[model samples]
Target: MHRDLHAVTFDCWGTLIYEPKREQGALARREIFRKCLQQHGVEVTEERASDALREVWLRHWREWQAGISSDATDMAGWGLEAFGIHERAAVERLGCELAEASLEQEVRALDGARETLEQLARREIRRALICDTGYSPGRVVRQLLQREGLLEFLEVLIFSNEAGVPKPNPRIFQAALDPLGVGPEQALHVGDLRRSDIAGAHGMGMRSVRIRWQNDDTSDLPDAHAVVDSHAQLRELLHLDGS
Candidate 1:
């Protein structure tokens, strides 16, 4: 049924990259932000900085659900707002700094990630990346993809922070289509989430593939054109070897 497929778009988190749970990752990020503020001569308590970040994320979560998107530049400014520094220039600079530092943290690509992408490229299938960022900025995510050598394999990239609205919103999905010059019917979308990836693509008339890793549970979700666990299974299903 996907005879007309000309493009493939992927969800980043839980799909291309595996993020380990670091009990102290947020704490570490907060410390980095705190230090950056100190270097700028603005002092903020660690506890206050952490709380501000949590609050901003919670607010952004609600906003993202309502179809609003934001970026780390804003978070960097908002986080420093806890210390009463309202200069836009200073806040934006600090946000960039925070994101750059956070990129040095650990983020591992999923098994078969590089191999699968390389094969996709070898076969000349156009690919894109769409993701909603968490504590780390989209800037950090892009750098991670580059670090993992996955950046070159993608043709389009859209992150929630940069998109200003999260998935399930058709705008960002449309953005993915722009570079490829493909309509929804000419593309397939692969992602782990029902609401964001699958549903968003479905809503736009794009074929959707639901992907699940070993630890993912998506049994209760609506149907997809294909359900796959690993890149090998996906390659088999798509017959990417040119069979």
Candidate 2:
């Protein structure tokens, strides 16, 4: 599908990488969350961490889904405050200051991701990152990417904070395409969200691939140009192995 595409832009957090706060095994993230919660006099147990993380994320996700658009700057601050890190000391103790450095470690590329992307990039197909922002500022994100050695493989990086427009909006998609000097039809966007990536890229007239890494039932298949269950499947779908 869309083999003539000049570029393949991806959603960073989920499509090219796995960042599930509600999922377990994020030891570093657990430490960060625990530190933040404790500063506000809230205690998190091994049993309660999952519920708490999900509850907080669900509330924020609902706000966004309900079309309550807010600036990444303010929204992130609101999230922290709502999560009970209201005190100045709490914010400091929560490693907010070390957040930039911490993010470098957190931006782990998905398994088998690097070799695939390296092959894809070497083909002269431009690689771009189109991602949500708010949790970490754009500058910090850039730094993290650089630190993680991902920048060398990416041709362009677009963040909600930098674009001043959130996803599911055509403008954000356009912003990513504009700098690449390519029309929407010449590009393919891969993302994990039905509403945001599929609808948004579709609005911009770009081909879209939905990654089913989370196994969500709402496949967005009717609207998606393609659906991939794994990176291996994605490579096959792209005919990257000479299939």
Candidate 3:
């Protein structure tokens, strides 16, 4: 155990919990968009809706790579414009429905995640989450985390959509670290992505551990200080197993 460790921050999607039915969630969101467009008296096939959704996702990816973030509302507006339907009410409704669609899918916490957090809490090490939001914004993510019983352990939750910036950017990391009253060197960050999570935490002068149970990112970016395949290994690495 690192005697100087004061806090630990996590990346939500692949680190703590994962959407087990991601493809199903995507299909559901596409169907929801189709129905929303139909309600606006605009006829669109599922193929067209899928294309629009794909485009919006691509746009989001490009923006994310450039250190910009967009939320479900922005996605909704872009999607509506793609279908040539820009009714204000329709955009709002579609945004809301899209945001809530993930709730219909199964989201499960990684193995040993709760136990790790509980141990950390017991040891008085603060916890926080710095997640990059996609279709689901910060508010939706909070509901998912709460449902998984992980929210109570996290004192600070910083979503890219709410922060107006994504990981690999120093500001987002600071957003979590500042409120927790911990500096970069005193905290550790665990996440899946090398480009975003690992790089971001290191950039802030914090130790980073890359968890690969959910996603094994193969990017050429610098590797984290340590890599673990599961939260079980993470517990061992952090010396939370009471060795």
Candidate with maximal TM-score:
3
Off by over 4 Å in 2: 20-56, 66-76, 79-107, 214-221
Tens digits of per-residue lDDT, candidate 1, 1-243, equal 447768889999788886585545677778878787787797878777788778877876786777777666777766777677788888777767666755666778888777777777777778999898765677688888988889999989998877877899999899989988999998899888887788899999999887897445455757678889897777777777453
Off by over 4 Å in 1: 36-48, 134-139, 214-223, 241-243
lDDT of 2 by residue, 107-161 (tens): 5666556655777876877788888764465677777666656778888888876
Q: RMSD of each candidate?
A: 2.9, 4.2, 1.1
Q: Write the per-residue lDDT of candidate 3 for residues 147-172, one digit (tens) a residue.
A: 99999999999999989999989999
Question: lDDT score, residue 228, model 3?
Answer: 94
Which consecutive 10 residues in model 2 have the weakest lDDT in total? 67-76
Per-residue lDDT value at 142 in model 2: 71
Candidate 2 clashes between residue pairs 3 or more apart in a chain or in different chains: none
TM-score for predicted model 1 compared with the true structure? 0.84
The per-residue C-alpha lDDT of model 1 at residue 91 equals: 77
- The model with the greater TM-score, 1 or 2, is 1
**Model 1 clash pairs?**
69-164, 69-165
Where is model 3 poorest over a 10-residue stretch in terms of lDDT?
82-91
